[model samples]
Target: MSVIREGKVKRVLEDPESSQHVIIEFTNFVTAGDGAKKEELEGKGRLACDITEFLLQYLSDKGIETHYVETLEGPKIRCFRAAILPVEVVCRNVAAGSFCRRYGIDRGIELSEPLVEFFLKDDKLGDPLITEEAVMRLQLVNRSDIGFMKSIALSVNHYLSELFAQQNLRLVDFKLEFGRTADGRLVVADEISGDTMRIWNKEGESLDKDLFREDSGDLLSAYVGLLDILRKTDPKIIPIRSEEVHVMVMPKEGIKNPPGEVTRKGLIRLGFQDVKEVRVGKEFKIVLTRPLTSSLLKGLELMNIKLLTNPIAETHEVRLS
Candidate 1:
């Protein structure tokens, strides 16, 4: 398809078959500090796309209108094309990030109620915070649209915060963009992923892009972890099965694994100095269509040894349940 717009981490392309939709192709580029820091991280695009698709669909199911249509191949998604508004709506629940910096307040302070803020979408001006009167004076969007966006933003925050809480994560803050379709219907646009929000685990540890921004941990690992958790929690994502195969692969004794070493050093850097060893491995859960038998169990274990793991460097265990 023909390219319509290209941003730091996404490309918008005209859909050949659908006049009402556009294809959003995600890229591997990750940025922080308002594009001051950037890196091309492999697999980041797919993770962001997957997370956004899940979240937008979740919101849509809860009666929120969004631009998401459906996921396409790889990191691309089909979405309704809309004239995106020049304003960004931010919803804050717990104090963190720029809020603390701007107001000189400590992080982790819970607000009695959700706070909605607006900012200009212009990158040149650092997206300066704009007042409600300024939004109307600038004519970015009419008063009615502003009011609707604010109301929708608060509603979205309520649902999203609860969803994250169910996953044992705190939605510290997030940004949302709205757009008007060709038919003049307003809907949520852009994306909702770790890139556009701050998520903290129960221990106040970040499971979002802040890991990459602060050089604290692995960004891809965090995204993958989040995806795994969500998948497990979403009952509709996986079908119920009578039995399944569980496989765990690990480095053989005395074998040198570079990832394990890297993880060890990373844990040490993160103040886990007491950690003596770290072994990075792989785990797989395969749903089965039939009952597990002795013959099939043996075959799976053999397959794991022959194909899934290196006999000389790694060992694997297969279990059926």
Candidate 2:
């Protein structure tokens, strides 16, 4: 595979046989604070691919234009050739992340409606915000392109916010990147995972990539939790089923204010200032009532999204023994 661009979490490679297509390979590599923090977390690639595939397909079904073709096995996907624009369209529904820090707004403050902003996608400059006029002035894209991007960004926030609300998650904010086709058509490109969006549960608890960015929980487990919630909305996400599958769900590390947290407070007051952090998660053993097979195992894995765990907040394992 000829390399096109290697990004923080994915690698883009030129498709050897097709001049008009490319292959995107997701990596388990995780980075935050713009490369200040990084890790090679196992299962990260598969989680990103699954979420991206589901969301891209969701947008396609909603009559939105996109470059998504289909997800292949593992962490790779195929797409039509297009040049990515060096701009990120951000949609915000709640006060959080850079929005709060930049404007000095309180975190979790709800916005009356969706808000759209533009940022130049330059890591060296820390992705500084740019005005629509700046975009046109720089000749990166014209005013028409900016309007189109904002329109679609808000549209996406509407669809996704409602979609997540059904699963009791609040869509706080998200980032989107677009690409222009050879024929001048702009379409949604790149992946949308927990890495790009900020999500909160119905109870106002952070559950998206913010967990990792804030050092409050395990990112891998949170990614798994999100995948679980999303898979419930799409039955076609996976098609494996048998009654004889066993699964185990557990909380990822770095969790804050777990059930164990309640116990630690009393200890601290008792002069045990040495008390450290307490993390807690759950474990469930699933037993099926049919013969075991690879297909069934896959089905059980898909079912995990429904209840076994939340891909946004937990990590799980599957085994027969």
Candidate 3:
């Protein structure tokens, strides 16, 4: 077994049967603070592997070059061989963690724009921050390579952000690593999942590797939750009905959460007395292919009940618009 690199969370094994392929195995171990903190959680490996596998395929289908080939037995994957880079690309959307402590910025203060940073992937050096110019000057990666990595990093950021947002999760930040194939073709390497991302749900619940780092509750469960949400809500899932019809589910009567008196008064004070009340409700628009058969209509009704609206308080109407 040509096991080249074994990290705390994953290991790379060269496949004896395939020269151009390697087996990346996810381990149960979770590490943080440059490996200062560590623990082995049962089922962590499988959850991480599941999410990484889905995301690799997701990004690949979106035209991002990745080393992932296919999922193997259990928590393992067959991936293309690449000369791994020693730099970690960090992308941030909302301020948190080290960024807040180092820059004295308040937590959750959204950046005017997403910030991209580079760091050396050295535990001994504590993954010290590195400048793009330094990356080229030190001959680690040339300017062109740096630019390519940045572009890929930003692209992944965009896609992943949308991916999580679909499930009502905010991707605060993530770490990505890139590598070069034997022919020097740049491709995204390593795994992505809760371990590499800072995720927050619609209700602002922390649901990623931060649980382990911050001593939060049920680290493994959080990892599983992340994978579960992604798998259930991923557009790749079959029940998507994407190629067929457009089902718009709107409530027959809006929810009774109208604007407060102050809001109404403020609107009136602004010379908008014409607007007396504002009741807000949700409308779900799902696009699927045509030919909405009886069976499909039943499924849509089931969906409308299960995921769209509350039958007791709100009723929904599904229309092919």
lDDT of each: 0.83, 0.78, 0.78
TM-score of each: 0.72, 0.72, 0.72
| Runs in model 3 lying further than 4 Å from the true structure | 234-321
lDDT of 3 by residue, 1-321 (tens): 778898888999988888888899999999999788999888889999999999988887666778999998868999889988889899999998889998998878889888889999888888888998888788898755675567567767777887787888999999999877775567888999889889997676689888888887788888777878887665553221232233343334544554444567788899996986754456666654432333455678788778777777666655532
Model 2: ten consecutive residues of lowest lDDT = 237-246
RMSD of each: 23.5, 22.4, 16.5
- Candidate 3's TM-score reads 0.72
Write model 1 residue lDDT over 47-163, tens digit each, in one string: 999999988987776666789999999699999999999999999999998889999999899999889999998889999899989998988888667766775677677677777
lDDT of 2 by residue, 1-321 (tens): 889999998999887877777889999988899999888889999998889898988876665667788777658988877888889999999899888889998999999988999999999999999988899899987755676677668767766776787788899999999897776667888988888999888777776777777788888888888888987764333222222223566566755545778778878888899889655555556555433323444566687888778887777766543
Error of 1 at 217 (Å): 1.2
The C-alpha stretches of model 1 lying farther than 4 A from their native spots are: 234-321
Q: Ten residues in a row with the worst lDDT in model 3?
A: 237-246
- Give candidate 1's whole-model lDDT: 0.83
